[model samples]
Target: MNDHDKHIRVHIVDDDPADFLIIDELLLQSKRFQFEVNHISSISEARQELIDPQCDVFLLDYFLGPETARDLLIEARKVHCPAPIVVLTGVESGTLDDEVIQLGAADFLPKGDMTVSLLERTIRHAIQHKRAELELEQMVKRDPLTGLGNRLLFEEILEGSLARCKRAGTRLAVLFMDLDRFKEINDSLGHPTGDLLLLLIADRLRSVMRESDFVARIGGDEFTILIEDLHDAEDALNVARKIIQAVSQPSAIGGHELNVSASIGMALFPENGDAPIKLMQKADIALYEAKRKGLNSVQCFTSNLQTQLERHLNIEKGLRHALEHDHFELMLQPQWDLRDRRIAGFEALIRWRFGSELIAPSDFIPVAEKTGLIVPIGEWLLQTACRYLVKWRELGVSHYRISVNVSPLQLKTGHFVETLQSTLKSTAIAANLLEVEITEDSLLDGHEENPKVQQDLSRIRELGVKIAIDDFGTGYSSLRYLRQFPADVVKIDKSFVSGNGGEALAEPEICRAVVTMADSLGMDVVAEGIETISQLTRLRAMGCRMGQGYLVSEPLAFDEATQWALAGEAVSR
Candidate 1:
């Protein structure tokens, strides 16, 4: 390459015109490096040149008119000039040298000893270093796996895209992708294989999408794709479906074939939300609905989804308030001994009292489970139930147990045992007075073979608390595991008890078999959903030990339950 090919812009700011001309000519004479020298004869001229849109290097003289070169270098910073400033001085002024170096000059050169090679090498090195730094800054914004903009980059770029789209009267699309059953895949196949699968999926998605779209892995098994200039909502949906099909393909790692599906949700710009946070939230809401409907599906954010999101946000806000303010109340429904028609014990049901508004257990339990609000909710229920039972004991009301339903989410938590122990300890309630009611649907998912479901039940049983399989016959109830489970009671679900058309003739035979089965295993049988004398008589005839339903009484608040317990205590006396 020619010397001019490696061109350098040298801004020589000096008080003396003789010193400036001598340096300029010497730089021009160098054959190995060509210098495009800007002779700014004063600090004021240097400041004007610094603001110009150009770069290469600053060869600053130590003294420039009335101000020192250090002062001019400081002025260069105010103009946002990023090039390396090499301070040149004629005299050996140590203090001046130190001040100029500290003031942002890249290097110092004694005017008498300076050579073209030394000056050229320092400027090139500084320029190369600055380029490398800028490149690294750009790389930091990208996801290493997907090579797409990451969350940090997405936030930065989303504003620009929104502004550009709005100016052009266009729309942008944001799609959120969450791989279904990804945890199971990671657990069984190892994380390395899972990571490889994710990379492969990202590649497949990139191949199918437009070049204008950006893809990023936001979380484990979760990715976001942003498409610019998406004029219609259907365009985003089409891309989502394509991604769904692409992710659904079989992946092989170490000779193990893995089949995975994804749930995708999309939100359009200017319509769904005005900001990145709001748009991502809308996509998340749609994603939740997609998962709820079933995986391997795509959902677009509509007014309904936004409404649901608002409602959920309100509920979540209420939940935080409820936890702190003691807005929850416990209701106990009596379980009757089928043979004697005597009250066996009560099942503790949770009710939310938001001022005068009544919130049923069925209303918020599922939300609690999904949001992981169940962990706190479960803790509260266990603690409250235990306290209620202890209070009943203090009032001289003896009871068998207060059964509380445990959500599957609670059973899966690692702190289940500790929480229960703490609750019993705090309330001074006997462990035997507490029963955890888990549903059959939670125990079986069809995909799991030799599941630890029964083992979890056994752990609860080890806690000295009775375990009951509530809504027993509704799930994929394998008789094999049913015989081996650690359940003390099996409450036949309302569906089985009510039967078809309310006749319940077939239900009696089924109930009898279940009771016989429970008896054979030495487990108590509780026929739930009994709402009539005939239902009670039929259950009693079948040798059922306990029955709980609206027939005896619906779930009553703590005060009502206390009154009933007192009345029962009086009757016994």
Candidate 2:
């Protein structure tokens, strides 16, 4: 049995017969690979063999009768071709290589520089690389625990479905569902049991959906259903009611009976907006309102949610204007060290001044984040905060630092670390004197290791910039990530101090656990929204060293914050 006996099927897609013979001879001369080659001279013939799995790889030429293989490469992708494609170009050009790859070429080979060994290696690597990519794509598109379509898959299907609905003038519905009080169950039963509950819930959801409908698990306890050929918005309501009824049934796992209910918000195509993201947003808004109504209920995108929609639209418009016109303001709130009785530093907060009216961050920040204006806005915030830190250093508080909040979207970009480094350089601020606050979700994006985020955070830490995990306890990340993160400080969310709203007071034990956990991890804890003297007293007793809130004094301008800091004694007012 010779190793050469194993056949490697090759498809040479070039118009020139002489070039195809040369390539065919190259493959045939390989003693390591038994060659079965096919040649196609025109685009019409190439399209027929594109979906043929008999061909292991395609050697595509750059110029095929004045029409480039670039269009063919895109066509291969559109058809979901399985075989790896290697583009054969006459000359080496860096710009053309990038363009071909982006157009879905597996490898770009310059014909003038192509050797037997190089050709073999290129073809072998392309096949292996494509294989690995396909495997990774399958994993990326599915929920690992439940084996259902994930958000990425959901978006792809939603876009395609929306296109079909638009062309056919058919109606479709997007039902965004959330498990009401699922967190309580998850907390009580542990993650293992919670996972089992989710699988059963996923199956129940699948049973409710028709063959034509699509269901995806967008989050740990949230699912989205896409129903095409919808007669009316009421068709979606019936589906939602069926899903609600199915979810309300009891689930048995590990000898324990668990019960959960889903609240669904429906958005119909054309009615809710023609775009995919727009419809999703409408459904999300309706879901939030449905959640407000109680469990096992359904709400459609209607005039009731229009107020929020209008507000978001207005804020989006205002945000674009503000970013262009430099209408944003930065304010600093003092953080007092509980034990030392000195001002620790100030956390920089952003405010948007729209004409004469001052809009709260609560109203605009989320809008900014959704619109992806956060990245540019975040850069401005960091640069401005570092400048303020320089001002504070000049005001005789060199040891005190300034903390600026960063959205997760900002950290996802690989260039964020460069932004941080440049800001430090431009402002001439000490690295340790400027801190970047990243949310927990930023550190861990749905249990996947985000290399870009981790790399940026690690590089920022190496530059001596202080890293604080902002809104620590309120996020969906696990406690075990504390050791993995390079954070120097953990700012406990205001909800932990303010009792998470409503009349329900926060237990001291819950607050103590977080402080103790951060302490064990060698991270300093800062309590946020410390409005009450009683809350400050409790946190101090709990060994929390620093805090910032209304009690520490509301956000102040440059001169006022400096004056407050220079007061030497911590003022309650």
Strongest candidate by lDDT:
2
Q: Candidate 2 — which pairs collide? A: none
Across residues 359-425, which tens digit of lDDT does each residue of candidate 2 receive? 9998898888888999999988988887777776777867778889988788776678889888788
What is the lDDT of every predicted structure here? 0.76, 0.82
> How well does candidate 2 match the true structure in TM-score terms?
0.67
Instruction: Give the poorly placed runs of model 1, Cα more than 4 Å off.
Output: 1-170, 177-207, 211-224, 244-263, 291-297, 366-376, 407-416, 438-461, 469-501, 505-527, 531-545, 563-573
lDDT of 1 by residue, 187-277 (tens): 5666678778888888888898887777877766788888888768888888888888888998887688888899998889889987888
- What C-alpha lDDT, on a 0 to 100 scale, does residue 508 get in candidate 2? 66
Angstrom error at residue 183, model 2: 7.8
State how far residue 11 of model 2 sits from its true place (Å): 32
Q: Which residue pairs of candidate 1 clash? A: none
Q: State residue 287's C-alpha deviation in candidate 2, in Å.
A: 2.7
